[model samples]
Target: MATILVDLDGTLLPLDAWNPVFAEICKAIAERAGAPPDEVWRRAREKNLILMRRLDWRAFDWQQLFDAVAEELGAGRAPSVLEVLDKHLPRFRPTDGALEALRELRAMGHRVEIATNGHASYQLPVIRRLGLDEIVDGVRTSDAYRCPKTCPQYFQDADLMVGDNPIFDVYFPKRFGLLAIFYGDWEREAAEHSRRLAISIDAVRPDHVVKNLKELPDAVRRVLALR
Candidate 1:
């Protein structure tokens, strides 16, 4: 069976699904330090960006962000990363049409797996919470792979890759010779956002472009047919 490697965040799940959970973590950290949660959270986001710049974007570890924010807040007590994540995972749901696509693809005898750039502690739980494990063959993470999806070796066996990230999910996978699908509505991205970025999404082309998860099944089928 051919392997279909799909990105987790922003593909199987919404990108900002962790917002409320991160808020709760920040709130708890602030309470320990007698500081405002919103201010602490804002600073945490800034700290996260700074840290992210120092490492490969795909190798980003949320635990590192949590530790940085906790240290800055002078938190007397902080919940463990796993503790915070356990509560957070419940907030996630599979993206629209993601579940159906996975099921149909697997029923078609394709091997479906998640290839994500994330910390496994939280990422794995989120997959389970979203019921993705029901149809998924397995999952791989940057943490386990020691490299971002930008590296072709991240998935040497993937015949097809799908995700919202044009750079990592679509462009890189195509370089690795996988049939690619650029999912999500890229047109909604602000012009100013592109102007500020070093490289625009338009620069990284995929074999197929899909506007939503609901379009993914057909896109995948069409790509497979051509192969």
Candidate 2:
């Protein structure tokens, strides 16, 4: 049986839509802090990117980041900000064909696993809510190891369990000898993102490039046939 590793954020769930959900949470945070909504959004977004860019994932906690943003706006508003975020958890909906694709992969005898760069506390609940637990055999999150997917060790661990590795940062997974499946809408976009991120997707090249999850099973089968 082939073990299939999948990404959660844009790959399984539709994060593009979820950005507004986050934005709403930020807006609420800003309102509670008594700061102009735009100012709060600007500060939080800037801080978020800075924290995400850190090589050490443990250096920041997203909840703490929200709290700090609230503090920067002024104290006595952290609780309200957290409440706003907690309420928006239900906004994380998977893409249109995601669940159907997961079912097909399982029915076809693939050992599906979620290999994601999110915190387990956040990722697992969304997976469960989307009913992905029914299809996936297991899940790996960056929070578990206190490292992001950019770390080769995270990929090494995933490669040990699943033969199918979804390419997020190609160089990281390639270093661990996993077959890369570049999941994106456009080859040009994928290529550019890989280059800017300092990852080498071209060297391994992706075994497949899928625009949607519905195309994944056939892509997996083709790769397996070649093997």
Candidate 3:
């Protein structure tokens, strides 16, 4: 059976679910620093972007980012971002048809597993709460592996990698000889999503594209036929 590694955040769940958590982090920082929350959020987001671009994907740490934000704002050890995430996790809902897609893919005889990038402490609990454990064979996170899917070593011996993030989950994994499947339609996506999708499509060229998970099995079969 082909081992199909899947992404969790944008792939299985609404990526916007994280916005509130980050907002809460900024609020906490602002409260401690006696600064405007919007300005604090802007600065923190800028810091996050800088770190994201400079650090190796393996070295990216949320706690470190929070610490940096605190330093930048002179807030001195701001409240835990993990705590905010924990508080908001229950409100994080999976994308439409996501669970059914996993169950159907497994029924089609593929070995489905989660190979996501995020803090495992936060991500694992959300996965469990969403009932991902019932569908996927296993789960792995960047926190545990010390690398995102951008690192070829992130997953071993996978036939395919599927996700919405064009950079980390698709383009990067393609480097390791895994067939890449873009999980969302590019042209129909929002502008930001389309931009990333275009970049990945241009750079790495996915083997298949499925706008919805319901179409995933067919896409996989098509790729398998070529093999």
**For residues 1-227, what per-residue lDDT tens digits would candidate 3 score against the true structure?**
89999888888988898899878887888898888889876776666555455434433466677677778878987677678778988898888888888888899898999988776777788898799988899887876766667665687878898888767666677777888788886444434543633443454567888888778778888987787
Candidate 1 positional error at 14, Å: 2.2
Output the worst ten-in-a-row residue range by lDDT, candidate 2.
158-167
Name the TM-score of candidate 2.
0.80
How much lDDT does each candidate structure score? 0.76, 0.65, 0.76
Pairs clashing within candidate 2: none
- Residues 92-183 of candidate 2: C-alpha lDDT, one tens digit per residue: 67876778877887888877788877777667777887888888888878888678766766765443222223334454565666666666
Better of 1 and 2 by lDDT: 1
Cα deviation at 77, candidate 2, in Å, is 5.2
Candidate ranking (lDDT, best to worst): 3, 1, 2
Give the distance in Å from residue 209's predicted Cα in candidate 3 to where it truly belongs.
Answer: 1.5
Q: Could you list the CA RMSD of all candidates, in the order they appear?
A: 2.7, 3.6, 2.9
Candidate 3 versus the native: TM-score? 0.87
Which scores greater on lDDT, model 2 or model 3? 3
